[model samples]
Target: MAEAVAAGRAASRGVPGRSASGRSRHARILAALVALSALVYAASSLLRLRAFQASTYDLVIFDQALRSYSRFGAPVAMVKGVHNGFGPDFSVLGDHFSPILAVLAPLYWLHDGPETLLVAQAVLFALAAVPVWRYAARRFGPVSAHLVAGAYALSWPIAEALAFDFHEVAFVPLLSALLVERYDAGRRVQAALAAAGLLMVKEDMGLLLVGFGFFLLARRGERRAGAAYAAAGIAATWASSRVLISLFGGDNDYYWAYGSLGDGMADAAVRVLTHPWILPGAVGSPPVKLLTMALLVVPLLLLPLRSPLALAALPLLAERMLADRFPNWWEPGYHYNAFIVAILVMAAVDGAYRLRGRRPPAALTRLRPVAALRRSRPVAALRRMRPWRALRRHLPAAALLAGAVVTVPFFAFGDLADPGLYRPDGRDRAAGAAVAAVPDGALVETANNLGPALSARTRVLLWDREPRGAPWVVADIGRHTFPFTTLEEQRHRVARLINEGYRPVFRQAGYIVLTRESAAPR
Candidate 1:
């Protein structure tokens, strides 16, 4: 591994006119950009949590699960299970196969809080830049490599994921980039290891591996590995969804969000084949799905469309777009798109190389038209122009970096510039006091936004329409919060808690903390 890395560095330095010292300087600059991105990512998420803008639905659920893992317990997320009526014994694995989250358990030993997960996610997102830089630097020289890495670091997909909250998908970008870079570098062992890691991130990640298998099968001397990967991916997805999730007390059909197409995967596949015309309507019904598909490739100037490596992103995209049940699945937001960011960016890099008259590498050798186009009269005439000749090498990188800069103000990272983000006002202060009013080790039901604030110290449950009879309840009734539609509804629910042997011990800023008269800590 060390030898391979050294050789890759040497190859980067071999780019015309780049001395080892100059290459080192460029590496330093890219490293600094990555570090800055990490800082921004972590700060945005942490600030969102501190400002009381984060929700319990996922942040708290993941925090509770991570807390359980840190304590060497089953990854039971009471916040998620109780809210879903799945009971306290429910393991998150039953909901989504992300056992790889257990690897971060040790970090909880240092600081067992939701912030730990956010920071770790930021680091992982930024670390993906290393592989991205290596891959681009190998082909486009150090300057373009740095720009590509910067574009990836600040991409909208990653910014959206960071804005939403921590998720297992945080592992997707790093592992996906590694899989692409290592495979392209012909380090099959390392690439396979990365692919294996992705399988542990999510059950559906097998689709990515399957797509990569298709890419490998098309390459000479790679059919054996491709066949093995494809088989393993199929088996893993089947076992995890059909057996493991059920073993952990979850229903597989719970997330089968394609009922409009058919009953399940097989039925949907059969339906799509039998009625091919239905495909267009199924994928484009909402129109937003098409926008999302376009956004995924547009930032890279649609260059990924020219590379077969982009095939790896298709299955996951298809999985989301074809599902009519969940809007979030097809929406242009959240961690869903994070899964494909690295794949598309790397594919764009390959496409850029092919556009530069470089023969397609390995399996991509079949794309001879790309080279032919480079030699055509129009392209040749453009190349003969002094300006085009001078600027052509940097065009892709410059366009990518410019795209990121143009879009930054519209994404989560833009929140960094908002003074309100850094200023936690009265609501935040009241939330802090209300969370603190609840005693440690107590069973408490809390509002969706308050769940993470209290999760670290309390056995937190969702304070929803139905009362769970928790010993303590904390709610922010000043405004409508998640799982509740209106302030009137939230107030009514709190009033019912008061009717059921509970008294408000702390009330300020629309925040209320209640303790049951006869209830014990447990």
Candidate 2:
């Protein structure tokens, strides 16, 4: 009988069987760590809000869309519409199929501020660590699971993307993590819900699901499920291309990321199907592809590669590497990582489970370089030293701790690779107060940072735009360094505003609030 095991078993961390309480204790610890992650992310949110670090471009666009949804209307993005030449009320929903933002509409009714969105983003990113904890704990043991969760909570990509600004991609990590966990556990219903949730996030998720379906086919051998997922992805891609975005978004297709392949998405698709070798050549060169993988895997100690799950990242990797327009996508730091990071970490945790409590192979110790070192009397004596046994026993824990340390910088700024963005002096109180005075529904042209605050209150055009009889204009003349480099260039627009029948209403700290001479305060 090959060793009859106990009906209920016990092992420490990754040692396998454990009593119920031990598992609960591990979960509680991991939860506490996730809370810590939330606190850290919240602090970043606060800094961004108070310091004027947040931008109106993305924030205002999202808030407008969410508010429109709250009002039970099509998500016509007033802000994005103006700048992209899409008119004052174009459907942002067409641009990206994120009905998921509607879920946040109720929350907007409660607090109705851009800060609400920021904190929500922080919480979502923090919660993503849950699946990481669950997967890692089950595979590696609770202790190592906590380590993986902590490292995941601090993963560079999450921090950078969150810190950069609120994006629809905020939901990606959580959804992807759920998809992996439920799928691995054979919870088909939950897995399908999670997979469907991805399409609701953004159009790109359709392709991602197709790739993941293949991963499922290859790994799970569930041909029906895999084919269904792929079919759904293909359907979404076709719908988005032919109808969805075209109906709601700008007049032209905006998928310029693949501009290198052809004129637009249609041409790009043709090129991809007809010319198979185009993928390898357009991976931004082999060296870049190698570096992109290294940056992603190195922070986790290259453990994710042990699992076939890494194959799921291929569609995203291909999408990015193939995009000649978005060089930023070729790197690990930005919002691009939001889509790819979860599964890689899941793979790492799963890999760690296989690694836990195992000794280094005799083959590893017997490698030529190791054997040569062992032949040295000093090295051999060191290997025979007192602490060697202890080192062997705790080596896995040490590795987890070390990798966690390596990824610490990312935790500092809500995204690891972009630390220089942390300018703590971000709040402009006087400017905020002036912005608060603007009435809701009034047309106002405002600075980038100020736009998020005033989004719900008024129609905000980018500051530099010619007011075109807009009733108000707000400019922080001295606050010229962020959101864009064109703020100083807008100084000329101030003269233009005065020339075009606008009068200054308030001025302090380079923040000048203006209204049309016809509509100026009596």
Candidate 3:
């Protein structure tokens, strides 16, 4: 009986029982992670619903793009010339990076409303935490992995990015996961394909690919694979830029005034160098700034010392910071660095765990005595040793920590709060309703200010251009100045429409709708 028991103990260690049970445990943990991810997504969706009240300029661009896509079936690149006549001709290439539009196209078909798109975006951003968590867990132990994931999901930059509808930032988790997978597989072609996909998503994604590739070469000494990755990354970057130029080159109004190519390149370099310094100001309020700074810095300091992963995040972070300088200095609108920030935090946590020690628990030491007893009296040894029992003791604390980190942020600030009335509320609702009331195939002209509202129904036409068989001409009565700031310019545009035989059909606060007369006066 003793010998039989000893054989059973050895058999358990050989594979079947231990390996199968471990896999089952892992699956259960992953399921719990998925459930947590779903909850976070739901919370983000609710917040987005409440926040998308005010009509922003970007919304107008997206609305127009969607309307044009609905009408023309053209990709974003082909729709460069259809500006609302404000400042620059809006290009889909400028806003809807290919990957983002790819995701949004399906949502557009499902809901066909900007509000629905916003909700979908929030959910996508929230679900990004899953890949991040998995990556962290694979690199670090469960304790540190949960901490890294929690920090990323609840980070202030991510929160702000979600609040604003910047799709560029949403690609971070996907990019991180792709890099990790490519590194592990040692497949240059797959890595290149992933890099290409990211480049098409956003021009800045090239920087991430470069940084990641460089880190792989520098640390792993996988020079051949790294060279291929870098080469592919550069090629992909060039291709995306060429595509954008080809799409928008013919339109004189599509010029980017940020800077010349050389100057822009130089400015981009400077922005990356100054990014960490600007973190304090980007959060706006001092308290939030300090807290944010602490969170960012702490993880960075913890990044595994001199590891390639630590260095890989630098270029991407720098590039995002540099890009932010061209349009504005440290503004929330350009908070694309949130992706790199989360990655940096993960690296820091991974570094911290590695620095401390990578060792299994000491209860495994009891296995020696148990093995000795097993050779003599296997039944007694089984009673004396319980490896599963020791493992179970540590699992609860790790799970509890993960749960607390994920849950605390949700309870504290996850609810939909009023971000003031500028979202998709009263005015947006009224505008959408008014646009829906208009008949299809209507030519709409609005004061520049009402473009977001007017865009909801049909495309706008300037007075110089004849209505392209459109039945309704909705005119904006707000204002037009340097940045469409004066009401008089709006009045002038309105007067021009009236002179052109378009009659006012509907008037609301700060807006007026005009339709073409059935009979033109001779």
Candidate 4:
């Protein structure tokens, strides 16, 4: 008995239990995978940079924030004093704080401009791949992990979302990572915290959180935890609504005309139910249409047989289907659902591989005759081990390559249409020239195009306010309109400025810059 025990110990030690050499090799493989992921992300980032042209809307919004940050240490509510507000009032709690702006504060401090902030956003987006990979790896093995990360990093929707400098959209990946992490750990508290953080990151994330919460509660049978989540979600929704209403000064412009929550619910239901075809429209093409449908239905078909991953994917699918009230179907910014789609695809691929038969490729059957002869001895044993070893060593690399091939094309060739809100005309150039010609600290009144540009250089009156040193006023052209001035109004405003001792020193496509006339002193 003692000899047998000694033999067992010796066998255990000789069996190479989790060898350091093997571990070192695994670490190297993981490192290579991570490095490859970074390379792909870097390539995607470079591509995005090339593809991205600063849109007029982004410039207008970013310039407003930058000007506010530079002058008042806060984002200006309006360009000119009329209807100046912060935050999206239409969505619950949509406009309380500009999350991206707050995060970009450091970047602003480094080099205060929209270009700097855009770069910062791109960098944050790239970094999101790490957590995404971790989430995939934990559930589906390192192979699926690398694939999911690469797919997410290069996704078209994420690339397009960068155009708007939108704060709400960035939360998709961040919140997804947190949800995946907490769900994997089976920690209710951490999950709740993640949910709350997601909601705080953006109001739309609340829909994601609610869907995920119900999914978790249903799957895990955690009644108390689920109840807590439901309660918190309700409270957050209410609080966000109240805060938004107050911020917008009871203006219901952002909200639908439904007078109450019940009416809003009815409206939301009508929007979704009546517009079933919006799903295909949202995806924008037949291929994407097919892909989107496959993504939703495929995993669900697998749910009865495989629960964990399907559970994770269900919330994402539900969020996309339920939140259909967005303004445009093809609007690239609304493509936040791509993150969900990517995750679900990865889950489906993982399930497929997991369900695959544990057998050698059929091509090996040609060698079956030789193997039959070899099976009379030890040679067949070696042949059986070879396939397993090959699979173990190369699976992750193969999966990564396959995922890249499937998903990279979307980002590489996605359509970007112009939204025609800004002009490339000589207006900006003229405005810049006018500001440059103005005397330092000159009191100036300029159009919208000129105001933000001049705000940094001099005290510009936006809406015909009395010039205090460097005071910028958004000119109130009656009924709270500024640059949307009719031809008649534009002529009147220009004439009035001239009569008030302002001289046009520079003219651009859409704006005229005027400095206080030398004849008039403060």
Best candidate according to TM-score: 1
The estimated TM-scores of all candidates read 0.90, 0.84, 0.63, 0.59
Q: Where does candidate 2 have its weakest 10-residue lDDT segment? A: 1-10
Candidate 4 overall lDDT versus native:
0.47
lDDT string for model 4 (286-323, tens) is: 34434554534332334223433445445445444333
Clashes within 3 Å, all models in order: 0, 15, 22, 14
- Top candidate on lDDT is 1
Error of 2 at 253 (Å): 1.8
Q: lDDT of candidate 1 vs native? A: 0.85
Please provide, for model 3 over 1-522, each residue's C-alpha lDDT reduced to its tens digit, 9 standing for 90 to 100: 232233223222322233666544543444444445445554554444343322334444555566446554543321123333322344566543454455565556665555554555555455444445555555543434444555555655565555544354566665565555454445556656656666766655666776776766875467776676667666666555545545543332233332321254456347636665554343343243344334444434534343556666666544333332333323333345466654565555545545543454567646887556556765566546787445543342244235335533443234444344335655555555555556654554433334444444455433223233334655445323223446676577567667767677677644566766463321
Worst 10 residues of 1 by lDDT: 1-10
Model 3 lDDT at residue 160: 56
Q: What local lDDT does model 2 show for residue 162?
A: 72
lDDT (0 to 1) per candidate: 0.85, 0.72, 0.49, 0.47
Give each prediction's root-mean-square deviation over alpha carbons. Answer: 5.5, 6.2, 11.3, 11.2
